[model samples]
Target: MSTTLTLSTFDAPARPLNIPLPIDPPEGGWTWPPTSVTLIAGENDAVLIDTLPTVEDAADLADWIEASGKRLTHIFITHGHIDHYLGTAPLKARFPDVKVVSTAATAGIIAEEQKTKRDTTTYSAIFADDLVEEVVIPEALPADGRFDLEGHDIIGVSAGQSDTSESSYAWVPELSAVVVGDIAYNDVHAALIETTTPETRKGWIATLEEIQGRNPQVVVASHRKADAVNDAGALAKTIEYVELGDKLLSTDPRPTLAEFVARMVEANPTRANVTTAIYSGAVQGLR
Candidate 1:
């Protein structure tokens, strides 16, 4: 049988960001963007496309995978963001036979995240009890970024920058799916923590267009609404969101963090994690 794909979403609730912000959160406070983890299942084995963040969440994810009854042969990481890989060790412990892999650049970034304790220190303080303590770095994938499961090919496409640097995506040929970590955010605010300038924003759009050029039927975004459908349409939505961010930030006299957040909320009132996304942009992008 050909490979079939599925997803599990973790509805991570909004929490207070411990770091100081240019403006305070809305009355309702901030919520984190939900995470989506994909599973590509073949006849006898499966490949997990991404992992969740906290130990509790990963254990829950592990339970969900165990219920599927497919032997997980590999855990594929699409990027270096801590939220994408923090739960890896727990998953590794549960599926010891599964090999964890990512592009060499991603692996390098993962190492750097660990060395700098960016996640362990900052995120841990914010997430408090939800964060993972054990750090598990992945092995580097072959330079070509080709791997397989049950004879089907899964290639890693280079995504120069989206939310963060050294990002990449997983392309499954037989399934016509691309597991794009943060390259796209469906019905949610795009993470612009690292995407500041017009050039970088355009570059991100270029990368999304490149992924679109691949003509994949299924586009799995790492952060999305729990009920959002996976389809090629997300590519356009992400591109539009990035463009909106650039437009808002590029005014002759840029809006303050408060005005920026207010305008974003006005535009995307229904999008989840609006405060956190805008606050992140204010902190990183506005600087």
Candidate 2:
């Protein structure tokens, strides 16, 4: 018999991690980490998809998990972005028995996440003294193996490269849900920093296409609109975001970063976290 599968979502409020720009002194602050994490509850155990960004954020999520009354069996990290899994250490301490796992490529990203955090001006400027000091490095998920839980198989979809390198999605068959990390964003500005070229951006869209091929009813993304958290149409919104980005980037006259930002902001007037993110993408020829 198929076990009854239940999924719950947790959203952390957005905060500032300042980033400097060439023209605009500072366009944004305190509106980014509307990060959404998932808890998949099964008959005897639970699985978590992605962690929050800061120690405080993780602690809050940890408390919620403990109160949920489900044993955290495996913490599934969707990708390697520090924001996506930085809270792994704190969660591990709270749930000592939980096995923290990720794709081999993600594990490699974890190894370098700290250094990346420390090196970034925007990240280090805000969290210089208090970054995730002790990152809980995860073991590689089984090769070509299904992450079995309560009769459900949590498989990883290789998203060639997204906002970061070696990104992926956690595809759970029983629930028809895909825990998309940074590969697909919902109602928020898609981070296009990684899509600096035509090829990579195409790859990102292809990854989104892969998600559609699975025909998931529940689409969960790491970053999402707080009001519409876990919206089933999130996947389409993400696809739209990227397509819009492409159009802005390859327009006739070649609009500058400033032009792209203004247009994107006007179009997505209410989307949170547009500052350095859009600037970066625009300058890098993404937006």
Candidate 3:
């Protein structure tokens, strides 16, 4: 029997920690919201982590920032995925002074993808026409360093490799919190990897361990609720998911992608999207 887990309400004083972004391609029957964006407020200024998947959601976040009476000093792009970065242009418009930041690798990918979409009309049709015109690539930030903002230090960690050459993680020491993009997913699902290697996965596991060692009281994931992370529990669950994918890949007469996905769903019915994402990642890895 599958059990339902209810998340407690997350209320923070400075700004709303986790704001659910409406999921697109809504026919997938995904349980939890597909994307989550976080706002980390300091004494003087605030930082907005990954914008949502849509313009409306990004506007909502901007409205919330305006209401908080804190200037949005910076906007952090966790990765280069469309769902995470596509809504940034509007957000930037709302806070014109806020510096949009991302890792060098992610910045390059964003620019390259934007150019490709413009060059090939075939792929351009995949995105909404309005969105294509509004897309704005963010400036690149140092991969591994700390930035002083509003009397608080924001640390950036280039944890491991992903679709982009480097994945950036943001850590706020004062809050004992970290905004980990796709590096660590919460109760949702892993993202489909455009580029990932076995060695990279191992390195990602190590990075997770390092983050856990910091004893952060709160962890804001890119796609799930922002709350306290049971380090051991979350990491263990990720290990299990990755191990299952490895097992499925090692089958002598390898199962078809659809078959493997079906098996995963059967094994963990409650985590439907997560199972599907894992299967998708594994299939991509095989290719």
Using all chains and alpha carbons, the TM-scores for the candidates as numbered come to 0.92, 0.89, 0.75
Q: Give lDDT per model, in order.
A: 0.79, 0.75, 0.59
Instruction: Compose the digit string of candidate 1's lDDT tens values, residues 1-287.
Output: 55464444444444445545656666666556678888888777888877888777889899988988989998889888888888899988889999999988888888888788876787777664477777778889888889888777888877887877668999988768888999998888887767767888889999999998989998888887878888998899888878888897778777777677777777777778876666666765453
Best by the TM-score measure:
1
Q: What would the per-residue lDDT of candidate 3 be over residues 1-287, giving only the tens digit for each residue?
A: 11211111122211111212232222333232345677776655777777764445566666877887777788778776665677777777888898888877777867986777643333234333223245568787764656656666777666665323467777877667777777765565554353345565566666677778888776766655344352435555555555565566566777765566666666545552443353353546432
Checking candidate 3 for backbone clashes, the offending pairs are none
What's the ranking of the predictions by lDDT, best on top? Answer: 1, 2, 3
* Candidate 2 lDDT, 97-192, residue by residue in tens: 999888888888787755565433346466423445567778888786368677778887667777665788888878888888887777777787
Give the winner by lDDT: 1
Question: How many clashing pairs does model 3 include?
Answer: 0
Residue-pair clashes per candidate: 1, 0, 0
| Sliding window of 10 residues with minimal summed lDDT for model 2 | 22-31
Q: What's the C-alpha lDDT at position 53 in model 3?
A: 47
lDDT for residue 236 in candidate 2, whole number 0-100: 73
